[model samples]
Target: MLYKFFVKYLKPYKKIVFIAPIFMLTEVIVDLFQPFLIQQIIDKGLGAGNINYVIRIGFFMCILSLIGILAGLSTIYLSSKISQNFGGYLREDTFKKIMSLSFKNLDHQSPSNLIIRLTNDVTQVQNLILMSFRILVRAPLLLVGSFFMAFFTAKSLSPIIVILVIVITVVLYIIVHKSTPFFTNSQKALDRLNTVLNENFTGIRAVKAFVREDYEINKFDKKNENLYSSSTKASLATALIMPFLMLCVNFGIVASLYFGGQFVIGGTLAVGQIVAFINYLLQILVSLLISGMLLMNVSRAIVSVKRIIEIHDMQPDITYKTETVDNIKGDVTFDHVYFKYSDNDEYILKDINFDAKAGETVGIIGLTGSGKSTLADLIPRLYDTTKGKVLIDNKDVKEYSEKSLRSQISIVLQKAILFAGKLNTNIRYGNQSASDIEVEEAAETAQAKEFIDKFPEKYEKFISQKGSNLSGGQRQRVSIARGLVGEPKILILDDSTSALDAKSEALVKEALANEHKDTTTFIIAQKISSIKTADKILVIDAGKLISIGTHEELLKSSELYKEIYESQLGKEA
Candidate 1:
């Protein structure tokens, strides 16, 4: 998975990837030659008192250092360029895939988790890519070069290098393996903590209204503590790597000195060889330290790659039938339909059957959670039925592509949603090309014009995020105006007017009746009065079609309908 992600993203920057390593190779070669030059100075120039030779070799070393610095800088620049561009593409594709996913697939994913995957997880992969071109490439090449050079310099003390490599490799393996699980848990804990933050901020009004500050604080602290604990555990595991590597260094140096002194006294080793061999050993230690740290990071990056791959692999895009429909005239039907949410065992809508012709106003009355909104969703193909079919204009809903179907059907959910922008822009969201007069007409129909006219800027007034600056009724009116602006063939208002007073609700309904006479309308309401005057009223109970008739007929023919009416109207009924 990691290899595939690298190749896929880096393919566009293959030239950069190739060139980066060349510079890194140049840097590593310069680093290896430095120890050899020092040995030459110590043994040939300094030992023989040839000041000119020492000065010449020292100048050559400085030139090599400059070349190494230039090469390192070049490598850094190329690596950063490739990694950042690669990260951009990775994040873009991941976001596109998420946007294309079916609502069913989205229902299973948390907003917080998706946010982390797009930001933090992509960053992890990019960091690994950046280091791969620099530390990763340099470490192995320098390690091998230093090992060969050191072995030749003083073959008798080669045991230190071999033993040090073996021990550090084993220690690094244990450390990285132990830390991987902790790092995964840390990422999950971060998701939970972020989720708490999102909920708290989004529902801060409710929390403050209910005086739940202490409750929210305690909840946040618990999740925050989980994140801290998991991160600490992972950090501790990787932290041991440096100290263990330094210990190996101390051992290798002590052994090198003891063996070199004996070999020197016996006339087998020179003082210059001892100094050069120690320098090479230090280089190997540095390489190993870099390798160990990179390995741990690679483990974490692998987790992120797997997450991105999972999203790519999901059979998530909503499918369309081979047959196509050019237009929707809002003739909707549910034929023996059964509906259930993804991963749910019980159905929310069962064996449902209904019909609504174009230009008819259908009021759906039901107990809360009795599938009123779910039924409306089927008309727009927000979800596919589990059994039987949802047909529109005498064809299966799947016959129309997602865009074609949803464009013709506008649903104003029970909860009003608004973006941060000018009030006109919020209404124009339903139809970006809508004219100014059309936008004003929509606002008037939704009973939003009266309050909007009071603002100095009127339609151009800035709306806060989620319309937090607007009251509940004002927000609902604005959302209704947005949905109505497009003048869709089918309109589903799922208790969208619940926030408005009875008079405002009646005015909005009357305006809809007059202005959108040709549009099929579905009104899902809690109050019996809200739907009592509908041309057709469908009583739903426990996900079944309990009764279907107009208000007067239902009162006489349906006991459940009469009971609901009496409960609401009391003496008036």
Candidate 2:
């Protein structure tokens, strides 16, 4: 599965991948030639008292070293370029896939986990690719070449090389096998740490307000400790590989030198040949150590690849049609709608049925978790109903393309979210081509113009992330202005005005009535006063619609509506 992902993402950079390994091989070949030249200098040039010959061979050896340096530099540049570009493309595609998922799909995963996957996990895979193209390709080739050269130099030394190789291989295999699971656990711990940190920062205001700083600190400490523990265990396992490799290589060198001295004394082995043989043995030792380090990286990359592929394999629950509609009349209907978050969960909305005509105001009132926001979400098709259907313009919403359908409906969520940009930029987010006059008009209708003009830069005033610089009411007003700038036909406000003062809410309502009388509106509010003046009122309780009438009619007919009105208004029925 991991191989398939690499193959798919790396298809575009095949040329770089192919060329980088060739350069690595060239460097390895130059390194292999060095000891042979040194042997010739010692046995033939120096032994025969030929000083000029020694100089000639030494000069050629310097040229080979320079060529090896050039090849190594070229390989490093190409491998880094391929890894970074591949990681960039993968990150972009993964983010796009996350954005395309439905609300239900997004709810299954936390934002922090997704962020970690895009950043830390992608970085792991990129580093692995770089090492594979550079050290990983060269290590095995050097190992094989060194063994052949050592045996050809002296047949008696072949047994020592084979014994050391077998012992070191066994030790490396054990270290990597034991460390693989720890690496996987460490990655998971890192995800948990990110989740805790994200939640702490996002709700820092609440933590300070409630005087729970110590509690939050303790929570973060616990998560941080877990991450540290897991990472240390994995690191310690990898650390053992290097020391064991050095021990085996040094022992092999000692054993060869002692045995080669005995052979030289017996007049059978040349001193120059033993010197060349020891160099070849050291090369093999270095290559094995590099291969061991690459193995550790490979294990971590495997875990990261699996996590990334899990996201890529998910199929979005909602699919769109290609059909386009020239105009939408802003009429919406819910026919026997039933919904639940998942199949195993109990239904949150049951048998809901309602219709609102163009230019009509429909107010929805419900207790917390009574499906007010869920009903508003259906109009935009944020989540499909488990049963029944939603219709717009007398056609099933599923018939229209997602872009065509959502473009006509504007929704202001309960949470007023704003990005870091100028006030004008956020407002223009609703309609990118909105003119300056239209921007002012929308802000006026939403009651945001007064405070906006108070700032020195007016519409160009910069807003911080999540509008931290603004008050609750100011942020709500800006969000409303953003929604109105598009001039959408169907506007759904989900308790968006709760932060506004009574006077401000009244002005916003009046502007909507006067300036956008043709647009259909759905107002979901907890306060009875906010929605009492709508053309029709729908009362919901425990996922069931108990009454549908005007304020006066509902007061006379429904006990729940009468009780709520009396509680808020303190009036007798």
Task: List, in order, the clash count of every candidate structure.
Answer: 0, 0
Residue 219 lDDT in candidate 1: 100
lDDT of 1 by residue, 1-573 (tens): 657767888998888888999999999999999988999999999999999999999999999999999999999999999989989999999999998888889988889889999999999999999999989999999999999999999999999899899989988998998899998999889999999998999899899999999999999999999999999999999889989999989989999999899999999998999999999999999999999999989989988888888888888646875554468888889899998885446999999988899999999998888988888888887788889898888988877877788778899987999999999999999999999999999999999999999999999999999998999999999999999999899999999999998899999999999999999999999888788778899999989999999999998998988888888886334
Model 1 residue 410 CA deviation (Å) reads: 0.5
Clashing pairs in 1: none
Candidate 2 weakest ten by summed lDDT:
564-573
What lDDT would each prediction earn against the true structure? 0.91, 0.91
- How would you encode candidate 2's per-residue C-alpha lDDT over 436-540 as one tens digit per residue? 999999999999999999999999999999999999999999999999998989999999999998889989999999998989999999888888889999999
**By summed lDDT, which 10 consecutive residues of candidate 1 come out lowest?**
317-326
TM-score of each: 0.97, 0.98
Q: How close is candidate 1 to the true structure, as a TM-score?
A: 0.97
Which residue ranges in model 1 land beyond 4 Å of their true spot?
A: 321-325, 570-573
